[model samples]
Structure formats: structure tokens, C-alpha cells
Target chain A: MAWNLQSDRPIYAQLVEQLRRMIVTGVYPAGSKLPAVRELAVEAAVNPNTMQRALVRLEEEGLLYAQRTSGRYVTEDNEKIMEAKEAMAAELISGFVSDMMRLGYTREQTIRLLEKKREG
Target chain B: MEEYLISCRDLGKSFPGCRALNGINLELPRGRIIGLLGPNGSGKSTFLKLCNGLLTPDRGELLVCGSRPGVESKKHVSYLPERSYLNDWMTVEQMIGFFKDFYADFEEARAYDMLARLAVDPAKRMKTMSKGTKEKVQLILVMSRRAQLYLLDEPIGGVDPAARDFILSTIITNYNPEGSVVISTHLIADVENILDDVIFINSGNIVLCDSVENIRAKQDKSVDMLFREVFRC
Candidate 1:
């Protein structure tokens, strides 16, 4: 899958967020080996160093683990994945709610609009 | 202290009435992609030329891989000039042959592979190809090398958005992990994602040199936006 990154924020941070989403979404399934740093960097069209930094951050967070000579793999902890998914969902919902509020929609009206869109 | 891939101390260059670079001091390490950014006449091209030994600094010392820019340094530096340097009369295949003959690090098979992937007809003469195709051909030749330092000046300046994306991806894929690529261009947003560090220049002087992460974290703005704020005219 192609990575959609914005230039306005820290690329490393964006990389971490995107990679985390991929993990939670099962795009990179748990316990599966991640691509080599250089390979992923090329695939993402980012510098290898930046990609390395992102991978290291994920590893530190227990979302990924690196074995000597074998490369990195996603954590097999389903609970951790669920936790991350919940956090991401919360962030997205909060952002949506804030945007709707700015547009003069109340909480009930915003929920009604979302429910209507979901039904449609 | 370990040696830098490219370093200059109080470097200055002038042409007739204009100073192209002034009191420039920079040290670039290996394994990084650096963006040298500035507007036209801001000395980005001059700094690149100086690195490639195409032009000498008027004053101060400049070194590539620890030695002065010369025949020895040229061996480790692969340069893509702003203009197309390929012979218009020669076919793309012949151009590959020329590069293979000139640079010991040139990989003919890699060059051909890149050409094929880009769907460029190697049998066609340089003069017959479109402007974008010619630029792709040039970029392929430059990236096919195993040089320690790559100096690309205005690589995406004249190309369309699609071609620009292709060129940037090519650079990312073809770069050697042990080497460094210093790309000089004004299109900050397009290349900012791939750059490990950015050096801002204006009026022939270095204004800022910082990691993209630090810039984003501290300034809370994109490099393109910061560039406008810094070099506002």
C-alpha cells in the first residue's frame, strides 16, 4: 500500500503513525516480518535514516521487535494492537467532532448526521 | 574526528560582478540525503559546481571526501548538472556507453534497467526525446554510478509533477547506503519528505542548516512554508 504523508509535519512522526495504523489494520499482520529498512524506505520514497528512526520508535513501544540478523517483526500481542486501534479511533472521532462543531453542529446533530451517512 | 563526505570552510565564489557564494561553511556526513535550497541566483548551483570541481572557489577551502575537488575527488562524486549534458546527436544507448567508459563505478545493466522501467527507447537519439525523457536519461546515468557523493542541481526544476515524483523515487531507490546525495532545488515540499537535512541559502549565504525533524518540531511548519517565511521578499 502506498503511504500518504504530509510535508507539514515531522516525517518521522508521520511514518510512525502510518506504520502503527498499518499494524493495527493488519496490513502488516502481527508476527509477520517487516520489510528491511532500506526496502521500506525505497517503497515509501523516504530516506532510509528517517525510516530507521520510525522503526526504532515502534520497537521501543513494543509494537515491533528486532532479532539479530533476522530483521524486525510486528508484535504478536493482540491486546497491544487493540489498544492502538482504540487510541487511533478516539483521535479520529475527536477530530471529526471538533470539525463538526466548528461548522455549528451540536453533539446530537453531529451524531445524527454520522448515523444518517452510515445508513446511506 | 571522522571525515565528512563534503566539507567547506569560509568558501566563497564570484563571477564578474556577482558573488555566487560567500563565507560558506558546511560539513555533510555520509548516509544522508541533504536538500540545498535557495532561489535563483542564490548560489545553490555554484555550491554544487564547486563540489563537482566544475568550478573552483574564489576563496577558502572546499573538500570532497577529505581531499580537494579534483580528478581523485571526481571519482567519488557523481554530478547531474542543471542542463542536459548528453550529446543530442548520440542515441541513449551510446550515452550509456559513454558513461560506462568514463566512470569506473558506472553500471551499464543498471542503467539499461532504469531506462526500460521508465519506458525510454534506448535506440532513440537524445535530440528526438522529449525534455522530460532527456532529463530521465540523465538522471539514470547519474544514479547508476556507485559514487560516494551525488550532486544533483535542479533535478526536478523543469519536470512536470508526475515526472518529478518519478525522479524523486528514482533517487530514493538508486542511492547507495554508504553514499550521500545533495539535491539543490527550490521545490521544498516535493522533496522535503525524503530529505534528512535541509540547508537554507539566500543572497549567497547560508541562512539555516538543520534536520527536517528539528525544523518541523521547533517551527511547527513545513519546510516550504518556513522557506517562504525566511526568504520572504
Candidate 2:
């Protein structure tokens, strides 16, 4: 999938968000190897160091693991991936709620609208 | 011992009436893409020229690879000036040959590959190709060299958006982690995402130098927007 990034925010943060999406969406399936830092940086048209930082952040969150010599791989832990997906879903829902409220919709109205949209 | 690919200490340069640069202190490490950004007449080009030894600083010093800009430093620097330097009479292939003969680090195969990828006709004279195509050829030659410092001055200044993307990608894919690239341009938004760090210059002085990430974290805005705010007229 094409990585869409914005210049208005820190690229490292964007890289983390995009990579997380990729992981949870199974674009990079569990236990699959990630491209080397340099390779991904080139492909993403970002700094290698920034890309490294994003990967390191993911590793810290237990979404990825590094082998001594071979390189980084997506975590095989299914629960961790699910947790990431749930967190992303929560964030998206919160954003949606805020957007709806800004448009003058009450909380009940917003919920009703979402449920209607889901039904449709 | 060799920490910075390019460093400046009280570096200053001036013409008769205008000071092009003043009291510029900078330290650029290797393996990063740095954006040297400023408006017109902001000393961005002057700093780059000093790095390439095209012009010398009248006061203080600028060094590349721990040595002052000179023949020694020139060997490690691959520069792409804003103007086309290729002899219009020479064909693209011949131009590649000329670079190969002059630069020890120029990679013939890489140049050929880039040329092929750009779909540039090697047999066409430099004068015959469109402006965008000529720019692409020049970029290919410059990037083919495995130099320790790549100084590109307004590399995408006159190119179209498509060509700009190609040039940007070429730089990204061809960059050597053992070296550093300093790209000077006023078009900050177009090049913001690819840069590891950015150095803002204004009125012959170094203004702000920081990593792109740090700038965003602190300022909470894009580099281009921050540049607009900092250098607002």
C-alpha cells in the first residue's frame, strides 16, 4: 500500500502511524520481515534515521522484534496486534465524535447517525 | 575524528556592497539529507558555494570532511549547480564520459541505469533535449558519484512537479549513508518530508538549524509553514 504522509506534522510520528496501520491491517502480516531501515527510508522518501526511530518505537510497543543479525520482523503475538487495532479504532472513533460535535450534533444525535450509517 | 561531513566556524563572506554570509556556525553529520532553506538573497546559495569551493569565505572557515574547502575537499564533493554546466554540443553519453574521466568516484553503470530509467536518449545532444530532460541528466551524473558530500543548489528550481518527484526519488535512492547531502532551495514544502534536518538562513546569517522531527515537536507546524512564519516579510 502507498504510504501517505503529511508535511504539517513530524514525519517520524506519521511513519509510526502508517506502519501501525500496515501491521494491524495485515499488510505486513504477523511474523513477516520488515525491509531494512535504509530500504524503507528510500521507498518512503524519508530519512533513514527517522525510519529507524519509527521501527524502534514499534519494537518498544511490542509490535515488532529484532534479531541479532538478520533484522527486524513483525511480532508473532496476535494479541498485541489486536490491541493495536483496538487502540487505533478508539482514536478514530474519538476523532469522529469530536468532528460531529463540532458540527452541532449532540452526543445522542452523533450515536444515532453512526448507527444509521452502519445500518445503511 | 571525522564527525562532521561539513562544518563552519564563524564563516563569513561578502561582496563589495552586500554581505552574502555572516558569522555562520554549523555542523552537519554524515548519512543525513539536510535542507538549506531561505528566500532569495538569503545566503543559501552562498553557503553551498563555499562548501563546494566555488567561492571562498572572506572571513572564518568552512570545512568538508575535516579539511578546508579546496582540492582535497573538492574530491569528496559532488555539486549540482542551479545552471546547466554541460557543453551543449556534447551528447548525453559523451557528457557521462566526461564526468567519468574527471571524477574517480563516478559510477558509469549507475549513470547508465539512471539515464535509462529517465528514458533519456544517450545519443541526443544536450542542446536538443528539453530543459527538464537536461536537468535530469545533470542530476544523474551528479548523483552517480559516490562523494562524501553532495551539494545541490536549487536542484528542482525550474523542473515540473513530475520531474521534481523523479529528482527527489533519485536523490533518495542514490544517497550514500557514508556521505551527506545538503540541498539548497526556497521551495520548502516540496522537499520538507524527505529532509532529515533543516537549516534556515536569512540576510547572510544562519538562523535556525534543527532536525525536522524536533522542529515539528516544538513548533507543531510543518517546516514550510514554520519557515513562512520565521522569514515573514
Candidate 3:
């Protein structure tokens, strides 16, 4: 999962975003057993408490499920995962484009920059 | 499955010139989120420390997890002091390792994973991290344990609005369902919604101890409003 130190958003939300991306990209396949909270905390260099919050949010969103003493696993519904990823990506990009426009970037300039980055 | 996670009888403590806690009695049930609310110099932290074994009571008996405060209680109780207790020289990774060594229930992998998510470098020394970052790191370590009880002293104090939400969500999500957590803080509004039970302390005395639902029903006002009415400072 990507943890952006410079991002204005909270770290737990960023972690959730990364997990969603991974699930949508088929990195952590649907219905797969995810790493334990402790292991994920160590790898992320964060407190287990923060990671636990992210996991709980994901569970609430139906992207993950927990078993008694068995740990969390990716949800079985692949379509739901993809839908959430799409919605989140749209929300993020829209917010960026809106902010750019508000900062005086023309629609053409924004599109051109987006195309340039996509090609690069 | 202990009957009461914490049971105190006529608990009291006093210094030479001041009585910090006087004739205080409290019973905290297992598997509940209890808030210890009080004003400054109200002995809220002192009471919590007493329960966690950081301070000894002058009189009366205290039992945590059905046993007196000692090595066994120390093992079962995880405490986050009001101030920074971590060695300034140690890195985040080193601190995790220290906890792993000291508390057998501490999960190293969990702590590291949380640090990574917060973009906190294990290699960076604690002395360099910002005050808020240090608090976050300490919270991660304390919440990582599978202890029977957690005594968190002002976990949300001095944090930004977003950070407060982060800390609260972490506490709610990480704590064991069967274990009890005693959160000592004056910022009652921040946590009032999530607390299963609220214990209001005034001048070292417990004025009220009841479920959030019961308090709301009885007072007919929100916790924040009640808090203001009670403290009024």
C-alpha cells in the first residue's frame, strides 16, 4: 500500500485507497487471505491501530471480511471491488481537476497535461 | 471471562498537603469502552495510573482482571502515559522491538505495518519526529498489544481535527471486543459518541457512572452540553 507523507488526506484513508487499488489491480486477489494486522503494520511503518481502522473501514465498505481468529480476507465479489475503485478514482481525479481549474488552469491545458502524463 | 475488569474499594491517595483521590470507588465491567472524564487537577489521570499500577493507592484495594496490581496486572494492562515516555534516542523500529521484548502480547508485524501506513519511518529517530507524529507512534505501539485492559491518557490531546478522528477510529477498531479500555481525557465531546459508558469525575469523586444511553435518557441533553454544565470552567 502507498503511504504518501505529503498528502493532505489522513494516512488511514490513504492506506484504504492503496488497498482498493491493489484489489482492483488483482494484486491481492479476491477471496485471498490478507496479511495479519501486525505484519501489515510493520511493513507500513505505522501503528497497528491505524491499520486496524483502515481494515474496519474496508470491512464496512464490503471490500473485506473477518473470520474469528482466522484474520481478514478480500471479499469474494470482484465486481463490487471494481465498482468501489472506479468511484474512488473518479472522485479523486475530479477533485484534482476542479482544483486545477480553480487555480486558473484552462480545461484544454488540464487535458493536455493529462494526455502528456498518460503518454509519458 | 472475569466478572469485573476493574474493581476498586474506597480507593484513595494523598500527598503531604493534598488529597488527590479520596474515598473513590468504581467498578468497570469487561468488554466495554469507558471514558474517565474530569477537569484539570481532578485526579482522572491519577485514578487511571492507579488502576494501571503506575501509582499505588494510599488505602483500599484495587483489582485489575481479578488480580492485584503486580507483574500479572502489568502484563495484562497496556498503558499510554499522558506525556511522551519513549526514549528520544530510539528509532520507531527500535521502540517496536523493545515493546516486543517487554510485552509478550505485543505484535511486531502489526506495529510496523501501522507505521508504514502512517508513512512513519522506522529508521527515523523519535527525537526528530513532530509532537503529533510521536503521539501517533506511541498510540500504535500501545494499541498493538492484545492486552486485557488499555489505559490511554488523553490520546487525542493536542492533535489536529483530522488526527483526532484518526486516533479515535484507531482505538475503536483495534481494541479487543472482550477487553476493556479506560480512556482518560477531558475532551469528552470527541469520544462521547463511541463510549459505551461514561464515568464523570469531579474533585476526585465519581459523580456519575452509567451507560451513554442511560445518561442521555436521564439528562435529556448531549454529552458535550452536560459536560459544559458540569465543569463550567
Best by lDDT: 1
All DockQ scores: 0.71, 0.71, 0.03
Query: Tens digits of per-residue lDDT for model 3 on A8-116?
Result: 2344655787777777778889999999885675455444555677899999999999998999999999889879888978998899999999999988899999899
Across B23-139, the per-residue lDDT of candidate 1 in tens digits comes to 899999988899999988899988898888889888999889878989888898899999987889999999999999999999999999988888899999999988988888998
TM-score of chain B of 1: 0.96
Better of 1 and 3 by TM-score: 1
* Comparing 1 and 2 on lDDT, the stronger one: 1
How displaced is residue B112 in candidate 2, in Å?
Answer: 0.6
Tell me how far the alpha carbon of residue B130 in candidate 1 is from the true structure, in angstroms, after superposition.
2.2
Give a tens-digit lDDT track for model 3, residues B25-137: 88887767788998898898888888877889999989998898888888989999999989999999899889999999999888988788777889999999999999989
Candidate 2 lDDT tens digits, B74-154: 789999997888999999889989999999999999999888877888999999988888888898899999988899998
Error of 3 at B223 (Å): 1.0
**Residue pairs in candidate 2 whose N, alpha carbon or C atoms collide under 3 angstroms:** none
Clash counts per candidate, in order, are 0, 0, 19
Index of the highest-TM-score prediction: 2
Query: RMSD to native for every prediction?
Result: 2.4, 1.8, 10.3
> Which parts of model 2 have CA positions greater than 4 angstroms off?
A101-109, A118-120
Instruction: Give the better candidate number (2 or 3) by TM-score.
Output: 2
State the DockQ, from 0 to 1, for candidate 1: 0.71
